[model samples]
Target chain A: MNQVIETILQHRSIRKFEDRPLSDEQIRTIVECAQAASTSSFIQAYSIIGVKNKETKRKLAELAGNQSYVEHNGHFFVFCADLHRHEIVGEMENVDLSSALESTEKFMVALIDTALAAQNAVIAAESMGLGVCYIGGLRNNLPEVCELLKVPKRVIPLFGIAVGYPAQNPDKKPRLPFHHVYHEETYQQDRSELENQLKQYNETISSYYKNRTNGERQDTWTRQMANMLSKQVRMYMKEFVESKGFNLK
Target chain B: MNQVIETILQHRSIRKFEDRPLSDEQIRTIVECAQAASTSSFIQAYSIIGVKNKETKRKLAELAGNQSYVEHNGHFFVFCADLHRHEIVGEMENVDLSSALESTEKFMVALIDTALAAQNAVIAAESMGLGVCYIGGLRNNLPEVCELLKVPKRVIPLFGIAVGYPAQNPDKKPRLPFHHVYHEETYQQDRSELENQLKQYNETISSYYKNRTNGERQDTWTRQMANMLSKQVRMYMKEFVESKGFNLK
Candidate 1:
C-alpha cells in the first residue's frame, strides 16, 4: 500500500489530545493547504475561524453540546458556508446579491466547498503529526453559534473541527462492507446481499463498541442508526439555513 | 511543511491523465482510506462506484456534459449520497425508512459523508503520486445518471472524481482572500474592508488567469461569478432531489 494510503487507512477520530498548542506557522500551513482545495468555479465560498481564546472556546464548547474536547483542543476551527464575500462583490459591481445568496445552488456550492477545504485541513494536520476530530455537534445550536460567532446574514456555521497532538490511540471503528456502499454505474439497492454483508458488519461493529466500551450494550450499526434517526436533532437546520439567506426553493 | 501538507498545498486539478491503470491493490487502499473518513454518527451514508469498463466510462462522459476526462482518467469513482442501505434495513426491520431517507438532515449527512470520504481518497491518491479532479458537472443529468447507473431510490449522485497519474501540469487556481471566507465569532457584512481585500484578490486572479490563458479575456473574479450566476445550471436540482424521494421536509 502507498504510504499516504497506509496513513489514511489507519485514521481514527482523536478526541483526547495533548495540551500543546499548534504553532502559528503550522496553522498557516494547514490553512494554506485548505485554501488550495478546488472550489466551485473558484468562488471559494468558505472560511475557517481559528479559535485560541480560552473563554471563547469554552463558550463554543458549551454551544456544541458541551463537548469538552472542543474547549481544550490544541487548535479549533469553525468552517462557515459564506456567501457574504460575493454579496459584497455584487454591491461594488452595483448588482443585487440577494438572489445569489438565497439560491439553493449557491448553498450547495458553499457547503461542498467548505467540506472539501476542511477535509484537506484534516489530512494536512494528520500528516503533520496532529490529531483531529470534527464537531458536528456545532450545529446543535445553530442560531446561537451564529450569534456567538457574530456571523453575518449570508454566512452560516456548517461545522467545527478540533486539532491537536494525540493523547490516546482509539481503535478504528468498523464500517459497512464496501459492497454495501459501492454500486455499479447506477444506483442499485440490492438489500439481501447487503444484509448478508451487514450481518458480518453488525458483528464487527457490535464487537468494536463492546470491546471499546468495556462490555457496554452490544449495539449493531443498524440499531445505533435507528437510535440516531428517531431523534429530531437537526430539524431546525432548514429554517436556520433559510433565515441565513439560503433559499432552498 | 510536512510532505502530506506539501502535497496538498501544491495540489492542482489534473484534467489530463497518463494511460497507466491503477493496480487493484492501490484501488483497495484508496477506497479504504476513503471509508476511514468521518461519517455523521457513523451512519456512513455514502458509496463510491469504480468505473473500469470503457463503454460505461464513455457513456458517463457523455452524461457529464461531454467531459472527455471522465472517459480517459485512469480511474473514475462516482460518489453517491446514499440512503438506500438504510431503506433496505428499514424494510427488513419493518420500520419506516421514509423519514430517514427523506429528511433534509439526512441528505446533508449523506452529502457531507460522501464529500469527506472522496476528499480523503483525493489526498491519499496524491500522496501516492496520483492526480485528481472533481466532476460537479455529473449533476447535469441527475435522472439519466441514476437511470444509467441503476441507482436505487434514496441515493442521489453527489459528484464524480477522476484519479490517476498526471499527463499535464495544470496551474494552481487562485482563491479568494482568507478573510473573505473566515469570520470571527460572528458573521459580519462589513463591506468596505472586505471589498478592499477582494480588490487584491481580483487582481491576483485576473493576472493568474491572464498568464495561464495567454491573454484570453481576463475576467475578474466578480465578473466570472456574475456570468455563472446569470446562466441557469442547477435550476432543477431541487426537483431532481425531490424525485429521488428526498422530500427534505
Candidate 2:
C-alpha cells in the first residue's frame, strides 16, 4: 500500500495526548486542507472555529459529555454547518432565500459539506504525525455549545476535532467484514446471509473487547448497537436544528 | 506539504474521464480505505454499493440528472446511510430499536458516517491517480433511485462517486477567503466585514469563470448563490428520507 492509504488504514482515535500545542503552521495547514475539500455546488456551506482559549476548551470539554481530551488537546477545531453566509448573500442580493435555506435539502448539503471538510482536516492532522478524535459528544448539548461558541442562526455546530501529539497508541478497532459492508449491483437482502456474516463479526468484536479489557468486557457489536439504538438519545436534535432555521419544510 | 496533504489540496471534481475500467484490486483498496474512516460511536452506519452492470450505470446516470460521467466512469459507487443492519440486530436480540433508529440523531449519525466514508473513498481514488466526482444529482429523484437500486428501508442512498482515469484537467475553483471561512473561537457577526470579504471573493470567482469560459460566463459567487437559493429545490428530500425509515422522530 502507498503511504496515503497506509495512513488511512492505520488510523485509530487517540484519546491521551501529549501536553503540547500545535504550531501555527500546523493549524493553518489543517484548516487549509479542510477548505480544499469539495463543496456541493460550490456553496461552501460550512465554517471552522479554532478554539484556543483554555477556559473555552475546558467548558467545551465539559459540554461535550465531559470528554477530557477535548480540553487537553493541542488544538480544538469545531466544524459547523453554516448557511448563515448564504442568508447574507440573500440579503445583499435583495432576494428571499428563506424557503430554500430552510429546505431539508440545503440542510443535508450543509451537513455533508461540513463532514467532508472535517474528514480532510482529520487526515491532514494524522499525516502531520498528530492524532485526532471526532467529538460527536459535542452534540450532547448543542444549544449550550452554540451559546458558548457564539454560533449564529443558520449555522449549527456539528462536531469538533481534538488534535494533538499522541501520548498513547491504541489498538485499531476492527471494522465490519468486507462483504458485509460492500455489496455488488444491489443490496444483499437475505436476512439469513446477513445474519451469518454479522454473527461471525459479533464474535470477532466480542473477542476484541474481551482481550482489550482483559476479560472484563466481552460485548458484541450487535449488543452495543442494540443498546445504543434502543435508547431515545438526542431526541431534541430535530427541534434544535429547526431552531437554527434548518429543515423547516 | 506532505504527499497526502498535497493530494487533498489539489482536489477537483472530474467530469470527463477516459474509457478505462478500474481493476478489482483498485476497487477493493478504495473501499477498504472507506471502511477505515472513523465511524461515529463505532456504529458503522453506512454501506458502499459497487455498480458494474452497464445498464445499471446508464439508468443511474439518467436518474442522477443526466450526469454522463456517472455512467462513463471507471467505477461507480453509491454511498448509503444504512440503519437496516441495526434493525436486524434488534430483531436478533429481540429488543426494540425503532425509537433510536427513527430518531433524527441516528439519521444524522448515519449521514455523517456515510459522508466520512465517501470522502475517504474519493481521497483514495485521487491518491491512486484516479479522478472522482460526487454525484449529488442522484438526489434529484430519490424514489426512482431507491427502486432502481433495490434499496430497502432504513437505508438512504445519499450520493454516488464516479471514479475513473482523468481525460480532462480543469482549473481549480477558488474557494472563499481563509478568514471568511475560518473564525477564531466564534462566528464573525459583522455583516459589513463579511460582505467585504465576499465582495472580494466575488471578483476572484467572476474572473475565474470569465477566464475559463473566455468571457462567455462571468458570475459572482454571491449572485450564483442568490440565484440558486431563491428557488426551492429538492423539496421532497425530507419526506423521502422519512419514507426510508430515517428522521422519523
Candidate 3:
C-alpha cells in the first residue's frame, strides 16, 4: 500500500490533544486549503470561523454539549453553510436572490460545500501530522451557537472541528461489511444476508469497544441506534434550520 | 509552507482524465480511507458503488448529462445516502426501525455522511497524485439513475466522483476574499467591504476564464448565480427525495 494510503487507513478520531498552539502560518495554510475545495457554480456558499479566544471556546464547549476537549483543542473551527455572501452580491447588483437563498436546493448545495471544504481541512491537518475530531454536538445548541457566532440570516452552523497534535490514539471503530454497503446495479432489500453480516459486525464492534475501554459492553450498534432514535436527538433540527433562514420548502 | 499545505493550496479540478486504470489495490485503499471518515453517531449511513463496466459507464454518462468523462475516467464511484443497510439489519433483528429510516434527520445524516466519506476518498486520491472531479449532474436524472443502478429505497445517489491521473492541469480558481467568508464573533450583513473584494474577484475570475477559453468572457460569479436562478434546475429533487423514502414531515 502507498504510504499515504496507509496513513489514511490508520485514521482514528482523536479526542485528546497535546497542549500546543498551532502556528499562524499553519492556520493560514489549512484555511487556504479549505477555501481551495470546489464550490458549486463557484458560489463559495460557505464560511469558516476560527475560534481562538479562550472565553469564546469555553462558551462553545458549553453550547456543544459540554465537550471539554473543544475548549482545550489548539485550533477550533466552525463551518457554516452560508448564502449571505450571495445575498449581499445580489443587493449590490440590484438583483433579487431571495428565491435562491430560500430554495432547498440552495441549502443542500451550501451544506455540501461546507462539508467538502471542512473535509479538505481535515486531510491537510492530518497530512501535517495533526489530529482532528469533528464535533457534530455543535448542532445540539444550534440557536445559541448562531447567536454566539453572530451568524447572519441565510447562514447555519453545520459542525465544528478541533485540530491539534494527538494526546491519545483511539482504536479504529469497525464498519459494516462490504456487502451491506456496496450494492451492485440496484437497491437490494435482502434482510437475511444483511442480518448475517451485521451480526458479525455487532460482535466485532462490541469486542473492539470492550478491549479499548475495559470490559463494559454498551450494547451493540443496533442498541445505539435505538437509543438515539428513542431520544429523538435530531427532532429540533427542522425548526433550527428554519430559524437559521433556510426555507426547506 | 508544508508540502501537504502546498498540495492543497495548488488544488484544481481535473475534468479531463488520462485513459488509465487504477489498480485494485488503489481502489481498496481509497475505499478504506473513505470508510474511515466520521459518521454521525457511527451509523455509517452511506455506501459507494465502484463502476468499472464500460456499458454501465455509458449509461451513467447519459444519466449525468452526457459528461463523456464519466465514461473515460479511470475510476468512477457513486456515493449514496444509504439507510437500506440499517433497514435490513432491523428486519433481521425483527426490530421496528421504520421511523428511523423515514425521518428527515436520518436522510440528512446519510447525505452528510456520504459527502464526508467521498471527500476523504478524494483527498486520499490527491495525496497519491491522482486527479478527481465531482459530478453533481448525477441528480439530473435521479429516477433513471436509481432504476439503472437498482438503488433501493432509502438509498439516494448523492453525487459521483471520477478519479484518475490528470489529463489536463487546470488553474486553481480564485475564491471570495477571506473577510467575505470569515465572520469574526457573529453573523454580520455588512456588504460594503465584501462588495469591494468581490469586484476584484470578478475581474480575476473573468480574466482567468477568458485566458483559458479563447477570449470568451463568461459572466462574473455573481452573474452565474443570476443565470442559474433563472432556470428550473432543481425541479425534480423534492419528488425524487420523497421517492427515496425520506419523509420530511
Candidate 4:
C-alpha cells in the first residue's frame, strides 16, 4: 500500500499532548497542506487562525468547556467556514452578490469546504509525526469565540485543531462493520443488519472504554448515541448562522 | 516532505475519464480508507452509495447540471451525511433522541464527519493514480437526487464523487495565498492585501482557463466568483434539509 493510503487508514485522535511548541516551519507546512485541499467552485471558503498567546488560549479553553488540551497543545488553530473573502472579491469585481449569499447551498459549500481543508491539515500533521485533536467544542459558545478571535461577518468557527507531540498513545477505536455504511446500487435500509451490528459494536466499545489505559468509563456505543445525540446540543446554530451574515433562508 | 504530503499538494479535479471500470479490490480499498478517516467523537455519521448502474448515473447527470462526467466516470459514489443509523441505535437503546436529532449541532456534526471521510476517499483515489471530481451539483436538485438514490429521512446526499483513470490532465487550480487564509493569533481583515493577491491569482487562473487543452475559455477568478456565486444557487436546500427530517433549528 502507498504511504498516503497508510497514513489515512491508521488514524487516531490525540487529546493528551507533550508540553512543547511547534516550530514556525511546521505550522507553515501544515497550513500549506490545508490550502492545497480541494474547494468547491474554487471559492476557497475557509480561513484558519493560529492561536498561540497563552491568555487567548486560556479564554478559548474556557469557552470550549475548559478542555485543558486547548490551552496546553503545542499549537492550536481555529478553522472557520468563511464567505467574507468571496464577498469581497465580488465587491471588487462589481458583482451583485445578494441572491448568492442568501442561499443555503452557498452556506453548505462553505461548511463542506472548511471541513475538507481541515481534514487535509489533519493528515499532514499526522504524517509529520505530530498528534492532533479536533476541538468541536469550539462551537459550545459561538459568539464569544467569534468575538475573541475577531472573526467577522459571514464567518463561523466550526472547529479547532490542537497539535503537539504525543504524550500517550490512545488505542485505535473500532468502527462499525463496513457493510453498515456501504451499499451497492442504492441505499438499503436493512435495519435488522444495522441493529445486529450495532448491538455487537456496543459490547466491543463498552469493553474498550472500560479497559483503556486512560479514564475508564462504563458506556456502550448505543448508550452513548442515545444519550448524546437525542438532546438539543447547540440549538442556537440556526440563528447563529443567520446572524453571522449567512442566510439560512 | 513525505510522499503523502506531496500527493496532497498535487490534487486536481478530474472531469474527463478513460472508458474503464475500477476493479472490485480498488473500490474496496477506497472504502476502507474512507472508514479509516477520523470522526468527531467516533460518530461515523456518513454513508456512501456506489452507483454503477448506467441509468441511475444518467439520471444523476441530469440532476447535477448535465455533467456527463457523472455518467462517464469509471466509478461514481454519492457521499451522504447521515444520522439515520444513529437514530436506530437510540431506538434500540430506548433513549429519547428528539433532543439530539433536533439540534443544529447534530446536523453540523454529520456534515463535518461526512466531509472528513470523503476527503480521505479523494486522497485514497488520487494515491491509486485514479482521478476524481466532487459533484456539488448533487445539491442542485436534492429531492430528485434523494428519490433516485432511495435515501431516507435524516440522510442527506451532500455530494457525489466521480472517479476514473485520467483521460485528461487539468492544471491544478490556484488557491488564495497562505497568508490570506492564515492569521497569527487572530483573524485579520486586510482587504487591500487580499484584493491585491487575488488580482494576481485572477490573472494566473484566467490564463489557465483560456489556454487549457480542452474547453478553453476566458474568465478571471474574481470574474468567475462574481458570475457564479452572485446568483441564487440551489435555493431549495433550506426546505430540503428540513423536509428530510434535519433540524436546522
Q: For each candidate, what's the DockQ?
A: 0.61, 0.86, 0.54, 0.78
At residue A1, what lDDT does model 2 achieve? 77
Tell me the tens digit of each residue's lDDT in model 2 across B1-249.
Answer: 799999999999999999999999999999999999999999999988999999999999999888899899999999999999999999999999999999888888998999999988988899999999999989999898888888899998999999999999998888999999999987888989999999999999999999999999979999999998887889999899988888877
Candidate 3 Cα RMSD after full superposition onto the native fold (Å): 2.1
Candidate 2, residue B192: the lDDT equals: 95
Q: Could you give candidate 4's per-residue lDDT for residues B1-249 as a string of tens digits?
A: 898888889998988999999988889889988888878777889999999999999999999999999999989989999989888977898776866775667778888999998999999999999999999988988889889989989999999999999899887876777788898888888778878878888887877777774546878888888888867768878788888777556
Model 2 chain A: ten consecutive residues of lowest lDDT: A224-233
Candidates 1 and 3 compared by TM-score, better number = 1
Docking category of candidate 3: medium
Candidate 1 chain A weakest lDDT stretch, 10 residues: A182-191
Inter-residue clash pairs, candidate 2: none
Q: For candidate 1, write residues A1-249 as lDDT tens digits.
A: 655666677788999889999998888777888898878777788878888889889999998888889998888999888887777777777776566567766777788888889898888888888999999989889888877777878787788899999999988887788767666555555656778887778888888888888998688887777666666667777777888888466
DockQ (0 to 1) for model 2: 0.86
lDDT of 3 by residue, B68-97 (tens): 889898888898888877776665556777
Q: Model 2's lDDT to the true fold? A: 0.92
Model 1, residue A61: distance off in Å is 1.5
Could you give the TM-score of chain B for each candidate, in order?
0.96, 0.98, 0.94, 0.94
Tens-digit per-residue lDDT, A1-249, candidate 2: 777898888899999899999998999999999999988889999999999999999999998888899999899999999999999999999999999999989988999999999999989899999999999999999999999989999999998999999999999999999999999999888999999989999999999999999999979999988888777889999999999999888
**Residue ranges of candidate 3 with Cα displaced over 4 Å:** A185-189, B1-3
Q: Candidate 3: TM-score?
A: 0.94
By TM-score, is 3 or 4 better? 4
